[model samples]
Target chain A: MKTIQKQAQALLCNSLLASAVAVIFATSALADELNYSNKLLLTGGVSQVEGAAGGGLTPWAVIGGYGTNNEVGGSVHYTYVKTGDYKLDTYGFTIGLFDRVEFSVAEQSFDLGKLRNKVTAGLGADVFGRNQLTQTIVGLKVRVAGEAILDADTWMPQIAVGLQYKDNDETDFIKSAVIGAKSDHGTDVYVSATKLLLAQNLLLNGTLRLTKANQFGLLGFGGDKHDSYQPMLELSAAYLLRKDLAIGAEYRMKPDNLRSPANDLLFGGANVVDLKEDDAFDVFIAYAPTKNISLTAAYVNLGNIATVKAVGADYGNQEGVYLSAQIGF
Target chain B: MNINIKAATAALLATATFLMAQPAIAEVYAQNPNLGNTPMEGTATFEAFGGKEGLVKIMDDFMIGLVADPRTKPFFDNNKQTFIKAMLVEQMCELMNGGCKYPGRDMKASHANMKVNREGFNALVEQFQFAMDKHNVPFSAQNKLLAKLAPMYREIETTTGDAVPPVFPKAE
Candidate 1:
């Protein structure tokens, strides 16, 4: 617990430092009163879950923030999601430098709800249900090829490669008992292709990720059944209703690496629990009232999470609402 | 319980139907009024801008804006604004299929001696956008015209003599 708190504090300090630097840059640019125009409006997508620029669930090729090709821009975002059995809150900051590179840091807190108490009682351990599980993620992305807005009429799509390193706070719980994960830290590497059809007001993104993260690192990384890297696909499609408003859908494939053990050592054989991971999908609406602020709302479906069939406590298909608010220059 | 499920299914279907119908409705409302019932391409763009008279006005206003800009004023110092304006009008008319001929020199030949840089060209484009906005040209119409002209950048931007080599070879 102390380690987790320290890590969280470190993350907060780093975020503040990054913000201070961005403010200094912005102040200097303002002092000059330069008309630094670069990219088109709304070409930079909203911040993603991990603080990268993209849709809510998946990262896209475009960098985050409003910075044109010659200016520096940064954004801070807060996101919340509530489901039948779990709740997740994420807060982060992302910076785009000259529209070329993006750097982000986000802290996620996952609340396990009644399942925490059930797991605690079943395992007779004080660790479960004691506190919310937290994870800190640091991400970096670089635009490699093509341009979303400039190449709108061409067959080529903008492409970017990124990596997110995640560190979960609860190391012991993840290693020995829950899902038998090998480590509390994992890194996800992904390549994303994005295209903007400006004339039709349509945007499309496809991402291929190599990861072993379970529930986005909230449940830790790499299960006993499969610890090696696995490939996953995420796709997003959005239609701009207007220059400032967009409606989109995202689908993300999750890895199902947790298999039921032959005999349970933690729980009695009669009350053995198995881990099940399923793909997630969402339909979202994002509205940017101004260039500096945006609000996003979505209906999300995160399928069966940490279900125990023997206990008759299937969390079922987790469906709920997601909301995010972002402000940037 | 059965009736409840039936009602839920009916409601879901209705919502889906309504959501699916939204795009078609939005398309109708989002249509550009300035298009004037013409297809959004080719000669129709010229027609939408009111043909020759409209082209003349746009060129006149654009030249005025360009001259007012300090960054671009130096480029136009040697030429008469009237002649420049007429040539631009002819070029735009020919590009938009206005049934007018561009009697002036080609883009590369005319710009070869100017040594125009990217920033200078961008300034001109900004001025053009301002002129179109001043004339109340619709945003979509402006973009359509600009898209057609954007390909000319390769020919017009010839800074540092990289685009066209000298006719006489340098002595070794």
Candidate 2:
């Protein structure tokens, strides 16, 4: 499975290269007809961790690029997050068509570091040996109603519906009796509404998601304790300081799918370390030096992931730095 | 034809009733004192642009930038640039509450034949921002004025296709 996923990642890279070449050739031929930079600066939002066009945490209703209603635009992004006990690296690309539909693909690698040793000692060497968990997310979004920019004069907002299918590579470990995950794959559905109040230089977004994944699907989907879909809410607010700069904060509610009685007994015996999942929050600053590129840096807190009482694996209330860079048309 | 006219009349009446029923419509109308919207409150926003004279200089640079940018040059080059600049000055002055009344026609009537599109509109906005930055206008003040003008895109953009500059009859 790891080799297959590696091959898939290689294929994704090759396809991205092919698409970039195609875009270059297409641009010269359709330069006059297709409008490239029709949307205002920073209005398309930056690429989120899961390859969506949004803030650092959750997807917004706006499309992924600077395209207007009559043009096509896209972006490529890389994000890095370092926490007290783990490090996550994400890279992805998105294609937005006619400012109405968005298609995205992302690959995330979560490095467990020293925690791998603790898990191996507790659950036996054969149960867990890998130092990292890798997952691929493929997403699709469609603008359902309203316009974030054109309808700025009114109270209307842009609304969109999106879906993400996540596949984790660590199938055997996830299905083991220790982890007890029902599956290594799952799907998430969400609806988002975003409004850009230009008069006040403010942007607000709200997203409602239904999912069964644990730790954003990095720890696989479902579990022995709870396997049903749960609804989560995410919110973001941003203030435009300048045409090229914005500051924002986000809060994302997550489901505690792995903290049931059975799972707690296995991972946190005698209440050594409660394995309850907590919400995620972040405050970010995004800067666009030019229309072609943007940079985002944030302080993020991703609360508790599989806490076990050990020398170096007490991963609770994780706080870290998030950095991302995006390049697009 | 008679039925079609009657249906149109009914639709117009329904729209009128809907507009009249909304209490917020009254405030919107009252706020819109002129085509440029009501003058902004307080003199601080006005002074930030260096007052009326400062606006004139900004308009000059704005027109020059318009003519130089490839995306917007076709619309301003060889057109009635001096008159357009004067109208812009008056519009900005009135919007900033600088004690000036804009004498030009409303936005829709003036831009009816320009065939403007999203690309052209955005280009014009970029050039305008560049001009304001050149004049050292405060960014916040620029945004306040932009907030007032951004909605005018509804009246200015007439098509989704490529922008086509209207050709005025040559002076005899």
Query: Top DockQ: which candidate number?
Result: 2
Model-by-model DockQ, in order: 0.06, 0.15
The alpha-carbon lDDT assigned to residue A289 of candidate 1 equals 76
Residue-level lDDT of model 1, residues B1-172, one tens digit each, is: 0013344345445433432432111123122222211123467778767788988888888888876776576766444667768888876776676766667776677676666654465567778878887777765566667655544555677763222322322222
Error of 2 at B119 (Å): 0.9
TM-score of chain A of 2: 0.89
Compute the lDDT of residue A135 as modeled in candidate 1: 82
TM-score of 2: 0.87
TM-scores of the candidates are 0.72, 0.87
What is the fraction of true interface contacts found in candidate 2?
0.20
lDDT of the candidates, in the order given:
0.71, 0.79
Question: Per-residue CA lDDT of candidate 2, range B57-159, in tens?
Answer: 9999999998888888888886588888999988888888788888888788898778998888988998998899999987788888887787778778898
lDDT of 2 at A96: 90
**Candidate 1 regions with alpha-carbon error over 4 angstroms:** A1-37, A118-127, A260-263, A266-274, A309-313, B1-172
